[model samples]
Target: MSSLDKRGLKERLTAGENVLVAEGYLFEFERRGYLKAGAFVPEVVLKHPDLVRSLHEEFVHAGSDVVLAFTYYGHREKMRLIGKEDLLEPLNVGALRIAREVADKTGTLMAGNICNTTIFQRGDKEAVAKTRAMFKEQIEWAVQEGADFIVAETFSELGEAKVALEAIKEYGKGLPAVVTLAPQATDKTYDGVPMGEACRQLEEGGADVVGLNCHRGPKTILPLMTEVRRACKGPIACLPVPYRTFEECATMQSLKDPITGRREFPVDLPAHLCSRTEIGEFARACRAMGVQYAGLCCGNSSHFMRVLAEGYGRSPPSSKYSPDMSQHYVFGSDPSFKKYYQEGLIETVSLNNKV
Candidate 1:
């Protein structure tokens, strides 16, 4: 399929099509040497370019329609911690180079991605200005490198998302922008803003697509997307964390005790990771609700992207999967009826003959 431009992308989503974007760079970032979120910015871009390229290739092969550059933490604050503060431009450029190469090779859209730097406070003029400057710098590099869109994601506050979108408009040079928050099942950002209000504010702030990503599974976030759809008029996207037991933990970030606030890590989180069937099923649900962008956030592997694409890309009335028939076949269609009816007849005849 041909890649869509900004208007084309929005149009396709309006038509109930899934714009599958690969958003879980943290998974591969850990697989390399960067064990934590803070260490990934410099290491992945400067020390290990090969791993980034390989991951991008894997994402494209796994059916990602859009490949976001590994700019998730490419800001100066994150880099200054490692004394690679001067390498800010290099890191952002290097990461985008790898993503651009793979995207160009595979014919996928390349998105410039940035996330929140700190907890957002609305009245903090200095902090907001600084954050916007950081975003502007990143957006400049992304635009210079020929990115198709800019995604300001994983914000805990609505104000940060609004700042990112404004920065995109200032430096993105007319590229489409996507702003996604990290919301909980309570329909609120970790910073205490309502999710619907978040989407509405971003839509008013000039975001082309407004939605949420990470911190929970599709099962938990599906209902929340309804509120997002109501607030966001253009296009809505949801990329839940690839976790399973949403009942136990509504979001990966809140893996702490509710009362004690004790956190757990390296503590058998696989139980929270969704199976391939679960991810695909989530994608199917997104399509039904008119969600144009179906993506993943944390714990996302290539297999997860593949499954999501397969499920969301299926034609209407045939999106469900069944072991007895091809996934492309519609449920309860003539072919399915014949297959089951013939099997039933054969079983009845065999039983009667044996008796």
Candidate 2:
């Protein structure tokens, strides 16, 4: 609609080329915490245009190839929760316009952002259908306004993700679509579906690339990629958040505890922090495992992605060591054979090293 080639973007994405995408808050809510009610008031965006612009520039400078518009909660229903449903199109268009301007100047791609519903309630077919329609309307608008791609990110269940894929096919038609899932504690969807199953569902439902983003940190999701790889045939993109462990949260609570017989006051700690180098390591591992696209999510910035791109071009991990050597070394001894083997051993040191 805006002279952008939707089919071309789909081709590129399906081919497994690298694409950098960025996402952050446009409103002034609790910084780096999970989304809650009253978190996306319109006034926050009006007051923080400069902050949004600065972040866009930061990501572009850090070698990002794409910048996603800050319209994760820009749907009509989510806005109605805050009594601003009328501002849906305006807010969504404004964020895209701003991101497009920055991306145009930096020669980066711009993707339209679509997040999960406000409440993650599963098994509601009607609600899921409604969300799908709203998402289709929003994505069509974004494409008309010139978005290079559409990212349905942080989805919590396979059913919801399936609806999103259907919407993309119906409205987006030919635009590239990337669907990212957020897993619960056991690395399964909130609805108890495995990550591999989710990936398969997304791919079968018409997603160009199936991946994971938000929810957990890099360290936790890195090990799960093997399963994801086995499940889907398409390219994988991993955008992990830098999260604080439960231990760290408990430690902070203890430090803020009061000594007297009074109520426990809430502690206001800074957002969880992560180093670019650590994120780079995660990206490198993904690349080594044949991941074609890589980026950062919550608690991560553009610098994190730049390190990732740099790390992707470096050498891969070595596989010279035998996989069973550790197990052999740990359970190699047989007490019954000690007397029998001692007489046959030419050198006792060689037997010790072998065991």
Residue range 1-355, candidate 2, lDDT tens digits:
1224334445666666656554544212335332343455433344465666667777666656677787877777778877878778877888788888887776667888887876545677777667877887788887887888788988878778877777777887577888988765566887788898788888878888888876566677776677888888987767766543233222212222234533221212223445656766777788778776677675455555567666766211111221333334233455555656555564666789889
Q: In model 1, which runs have C-alpha deviations exceeding 4 angstroms? A: 2-8, 11-16, 32-42, 256-262, 266-268, 314-355
**What is candidate 2's TM-score against the reference?**
0.74
Cα lDDT computed for each candidate against the true fold:
0.77, 0.66
TM-score of predicted model 1? 0.81
- As a whole number from 0 to 100, the lDDT of residue 19 in candidate 2 is 62
Whole-model alpha-carbon lDDT for candidate 2: 0.66
* Ten-residue region with minimum lDDT total, candidate 2: 314-323
lDDT of 1 by residue, 1-355 (tens): 4533434455666675668888778665774446465355545677778888888888777777787899887788787877778899988999888889978777778888889876356788988888888898999999899888888998878778888898898889998898898876467875687898889888888888989887777778887889988877778889988876366667665565446667543243454577888888888888888888878887788778878877876331112322344433433445756677677778988999999
Instruction: Write down the RMSD of candidate 2 (Cα, Å).
Output: 13.1
Pairs with backbone N, CA or C atoms under 3 Å apart (clashes), candidate 1: 215-251, 244-272
